[model samples]
Target: MDTTAAVPPATVIPHPSTAQGATPVRHNLVSLRRLFWLRWALLGGQAALLVSCEAVAGVILPYSPLLAIFSLQALFNLLTGLRLRQHTGRGARPGDAELMGQLMVDLTALSAILFFTGGATNPFVSFYLPGLAIAAAILPWRHVVALAFYALACYSLMLIEYVPLNLHNPDNAINYHLAGMWLNFVASATMIAVFVSRLSGVLRQRDAELNLAREQLLRDARVEALNDQAAAVAHEIGTPLATLAVIAGELRADAADPRLGATRVSAYLPDLQTMEQQLELCKSILARLRDDHETAAPQRIDAWLDGYVERWQLRHPHARLEANAIGDAAGLPVEAARVGQILTILLDNAARSQLAAGHEQIPLRLAISLDDHGTPPTLTFRVTDRGLGIPPAQRARLGEAPMASMHGGQGIGVYLAQSAAQQMGGRLAWHDHHEGGTVAELRLPAPAPEPLPAAPPPASPLTTNPR
Candidate 1:
C-alpha cells in the first residue's frame, strides 16, 4: 500500500488564507444543493399529482410512459444527491456552469411532464412562472433570461403539440384555467415582490460581506509576509552585529593599557567606549527585531529616565544626556521598554543633527516633568538640541519614514520614534527653536499608582542608636 495514496483528504486542513480564497467556489456548490432540494420537491409533487389524476379521478392517458418519465426524474435526482454527498465531506463546491446545467435539467424535465398531461392547457402550466422567478433569485442574470426564454418556448410548444385531457367542455375549462392563471399570476407577483426580494437582497448582502472579509484577510496576510521578511533580514544581519560587538570590546580593552601614552589613552578610550556602545546597541536592536514580543516589567518613572540617559549617552558621548526631574513623579508607573525606545530615538536624532552640522559636541537637554493641568497626570519629556536647524518645509515631514531630507538619509528613525510615542498615549513634535536648533517634545499619561502604604511610625529617641 502506498502511504501517500492512502492518506485521506479529510485529514488535510488548508490555511485560513487558502480557505478564504476558495469561498466563491464553495458558494457555487451551496447553490447546487439548494437547487437539488427544490428539484426533489418538484419530483415529489409531480408523482402525487399523477397518481391522484389516474387512480382517484379515473382520468388516464398513457400511464406507463408518464410513470417512466417520473422514474427518470427520480433517478437523476438520486445521482445528483450522491454526487453532492461525495463532495460534502471534501468541502468541494460546484461551479456556475454546473449549477446552470442542473437548473436547465429541472426546467426540461418539468417541460416534458407538462407536455404529457395538458401542456399550456394545464393550470399548472403557470408553474413555469414560479420556476422563472426562482431562477432570477439564484442564477446569474444571463441564466435567468435564458431560463425565462426556454420556459416561454416550452409553454408555446405545449399550446400546439401537447395531448389534451378532456376533463371539461370549452366554457368550463377556460373559466377554470383562467382562474388558475389569475391565481398563479398573484403567486408569481408575490414571489417576485416578497420572496425573491428578501432572498436575493440577502444573497447580495452576504456577497458584499464576504468581499470585505476577504480584503481584511488580505491585509493580515500582507502584514505576516512583511514580518517574515523582517525575520530573514534580522538573520542576515546577526552575524555582522556579533562581529562588530567583539571588535569593539577588544578595542575598549586595548585602550585601557597604560603602556600607551596617557594622552593617547585619553584620546581613544571615549571613542572605543562609544564604538562598543554603538555595537552593543546594534546587537540589542537586532535581537529585538528577531523577537519583538518580549514583555518588559514596569519601571519607576525616575529610574527608567536615569537608565535611559546613561545608555543613550554611550551612543553620543559628546552629546549631553541629562534628566532633570521638574515634576512630582515619585510613584508614576512607566512601561520601561516602550519609554526607553522612544527616548532613544529622540536622543539619537538630536545627536545626528549636530554631527551633520560638523559640531564636535552636541548640546542636548532632557527635561522631565508632569503636566498637572490634565485630569490624569501626564509625564512629559522635552529634548532640545543645538544643531543645523530643520528647514521650514521639513517640519511637517519630520517623522515621516520615507521623507527626503537635506541631509541625505531616510527618516525611518524619527518616524518609528514618533509612532512609538503616539502608541503609548504620548505625542511627539518638532519645532525650530526661536534661538537655534530644534526642540522635540513627547508627552505620555502616567500610569495610575497603587494605593500608598500607611505612614511609618516616627522613631522614638530611645530606639535610635547612638553613634
Candidate 2:
C-alpha cells in the first residue's frame, strides 16, 4: 500500500538552531568545474563572432590587441583548470570569494574587449547582467552587491573613452547595431538560464541533504535520551522487584504448610505462581540490558515470531493475538528483541483501540510475509485490528510525536516503535484496513541465504563422538 503521509518533524530533540543566515555560503567544486567549461564555450563563441564580423561582415577592428586579450583569457582559464586539478584535499572547493574573483576577471576582460570595439555602445556590454545573476545565485548578497557596483563603474568608464568599430559604410551602423543587440539578447538569456538554473538545482539538493542530516542527528539524540531514561528506570525498579520476589517465595512457603486450609492454599497457589512468573519475566528483561544485542544469532522468521507471540500472550492474557508467517524465507538476520519490542508496542495499541471501540472479542492479527519481487526482498509484518480507524488528521501525525489519543492512550509507544523501526533500517506506516479499523505495517529489508556451517568430520565407529 502507498503511504502518502508526510514525515513528521523531529520534536524530541531540543533547542534546534533556526537561524539560517548565520551559516556561510560556499559553492562546491562541481560549480567551479562547470564554470570552467562554460568559460571555454563563451571564449569560442567570442572568437567565432569576432572572425565573422571582421572577415565576413567587413568591420575593421584592432586584431593584435583583441587576440592578445583573447590569449590572456585562455591562459587564465588554463590556470583555473590547473588549480582545480592540483587541489584534491577534502577542503578543496571553490568558496564564494574565489568564484566572485573569477567573475570579476571575466568582466574586466569583457570590458577590455568592449573598449577596443565600441566601448559602452557595444551590443555585448549588457552581458554583465548574466554574470551578475549567476553571482546572486551562488554568492552572498554582499558579494553580489559589490560585483554590481564594480560592473557599473566599468561601464561608466567605458562610456567616457573608447575606440569605435570602423564599418565599410557608415549607413550600415544602425543595421549592424540592431543585429548585434538581437544576438546579445539571445546569448545573455541562454547564459542566465543555463548557468543560473544549474546552480539553483545544486543549491536545492544541498538543502535537502542538510535537512536529512539534521533529522538524523535529532533521531540519534532522542534515542540516546530514551535509552538513558530506560536504564535509570531499570535501576530504580530492581530493588522493588527483588523485594516482591522474596515476598512471593514466602507466600509459596506458607501455602505449603498444613496450617493453612487446603482449599485456600490451592486457590492462592495459582495466583502465587502467576506472580512469580511475572516477577521472573521482569528480572529477565532487566538482565537483558547488559546482553550484547549484536551477538544475537540469525533465526527463521516464523520461528522467531512464534516464540515472540507466545511470550507476548503471557503479558497480555485478555487480548488475543493471531500470528501467521508466510513465505519460505530462511535465516533472517534481524535483531529479534527490537523487532519484538516494536510489535509489542503495535499490539498494545491495537488492544487499546479494540477495548475503546468495544470490540475486545475480535482478535488482533499479525501477518508476516516475505516480498521477493523487489531487490533485497522485504519482510513485512502487518498488524491489523478490528477497531475504530484512526482519524485522518491524527493518522498523518501518529508516529511524529507523542500526542493524546481518543482511546485513552499517550501515543508514546507508537512514536518509540517508529523510531526503533527507523534505527533498524525499516519503516512503520499505518493505513485504514479495507474492512474496518487500522493496519500498522512494518517493512524491513531481508537479505537471505545465510549459509549453514559445514558439518564436522564423523568419528570412527570404534571411537567415541566428540560432539
Candidate 3:
C-alpha cells in the first residue's frame, strides 16, 4: 500500500529542467596513487636487476651514478605518494596538467639514468614505451602527442651524446646486450597489450553507465511537467462541467412541466440521457486527475489488474483491447492503484494516437507475466498497441515534460506512466513492438508480504496453579 504523504498539485513548484542530453566525461585519478606505489616496486626491481648483472654476470658497470639516480627516484616517489595519499577521491583530483607534470619528471629521470648507462644502447630504454602508453590512456590526445614529441627529442639527444657502457670483456658484450634487449621487448609488450587494454575497457564501461543514468533523469524531469499541466487543467475544467450540468438539469425540469406537451417531453428524453452520460464522463475524468490513484491497498495484483482492464475498456468503448496473465496470476502482492494508473496512462496515449490516425477501432493488449521461482517474485506488465509509432524527434525527448501537438493534444501520458513505475522501485521503458507498434513495459519490485506475529506462549504450570 502507498504510505507516502499527499503531494499537492505541481503548479506551485517550478518545472524541472530537462536540457541535459548526456553526462559530462569525468577524468578519474584514483589510480594515480597506485601508479606511484608501482613506481616504488619497479625501483626495487631496477636495483636488483643492476646487482644481478654486476655480481652474478661479472659485468663491469658504473654503479655510483646509476645508484644515485635510483636513490633520487625512490625519494621522489616517497614524497609524491605521501602528498597524493590524502586525495583518494575524485573531489581532490589534480587536473591533467598536474598528472602530465609527474609523467614528465619520470621521463627526465629515466633519461638521466639512460645517459649514464649507455645512452640509446641501454636495454632499459624500452621502458619509455610503457610510460608513453600510460600517458595516452589517461591524458587528452593533445597532451599525449606532446609527451610523444618530448620522448622523441630525448632519444635523439641520447644518440648523439652520453656516457658509453663499460664492457670489461668486449668478446661477450654482443651476446649479453642481445639478451637484455629481448627481455625489454617482452616486458614492454606485456604492459601495453594486457594492462592498457584492460584499463581502456573499464573507462568505456563507466561512460556507458553514465550516459544511461543521464537519459533516465531527463525522462523523469519532463514527465513532471505533465503533472503540472494536469493539475492546472483539472482546475479549469470544473467551471465548464458545472455549467453543462446545470443546463441539463434545467432542460429536464422544463420537460417534466405539465405545460409542456407529452410529445415534446418524449423528444427531449433521448437527448437528456445523452447529456447525463456526458456529464458523468466529465466527472470521471476530473476524478482521475484529482486522485493520483494511490488508494489501492496491497492485494493480489493479478485480480486488481483484471478489474482495472474491464473498467478501462468501458471508458473507451470503441477501442479493441485485451488483458492476459502469462503465468500463475494469483497471490502476488502489490499496490494495485498505482500500477493501474500507470497502465491507464499508457493505454490512453495509445488510444488517442490510433484515433488520430483515423482508425475505426483501436486495438491494444495488456499482458502480465509473473515469475515466483526467485525471492520477491517479479512482475512485468507490458502494454502493446498497433497505432502509429512514436516519431523520431520525440523518441529521445519522451517523458521529460508536457509537450503539445498542433492538434490540441497534451503529450504527458507516457511521462506520467514512467513516473508512476519509478515510485514503486521499478522503471518504465518504451520499445518498438515486434508487430509494428509500441510496447510500454512496467517492471516493478513485487510487494513483500508482512511477517506474521508470533503465537502467544502457553501458560506456565506454576502460573496456572496461581490462577
| TM-score versus the correct structure, for each prediction | 0.47, 0.51, 0.50
lDDT per residue as tens, model 1, 389-422: 7777777767654465556656655665666676
What ranking emerges by lDDT with the best candidate at the front? Answer: 2, 3, 1
Query: CA lDDT of 127 in candidate 1?
Result: 76
- Give residue 363's lDDT in candidate 2 (0 to 100): 82
Best by lDDT: 2
Predicted model with the maximum TM-score = 2
Distance from true position, residue 38, model 3, in Å?
Answer: 2.8
Greater-TM-score candidate between 2 and 3 = 2
Worst 10 residues of 1 by lDDT: 1-10
lDDT of 1 at 454: 25
Off by over 4 Å in 3: 1-27, 218-222, 225-229, 232-236, 245-467
lDDT comparing candidate 2 with the true structure: 0.72
How do the residues 30-67 of candidate 3 rate in per-residue lDDT, one tens digit apiece?
Answer: 44654586677668777887888866555666888888
Model 1 per-residue lDDT at 324: 62
For model 2, the superposed segments whose C-alpha errors exceed 4 Å read 1-27, 87-91, 218-222, 248-467
The clash tally of candidate 2 reads 0
lDDT of 2 by residue, 1-467 (tens): 11211122223554333323222223457667777988999999989987888676668988899999999999999999987886435345667788889889988998899999989888889998988887788778999999999999999999899998888888888888888899999999899888888878877876776676678777877677557545433632443465567667877777677876365556677666666656766765566555535214555554465556765565555578877665444235455666666776677678767767788777888877779888878888888998887888988998788777876566766776677678667888989989888999989887565554422432221111111
Question: Which pairs, if any, clash in model 2?
Answer: none
- How many collisions between residues are there in candidate 3? 3
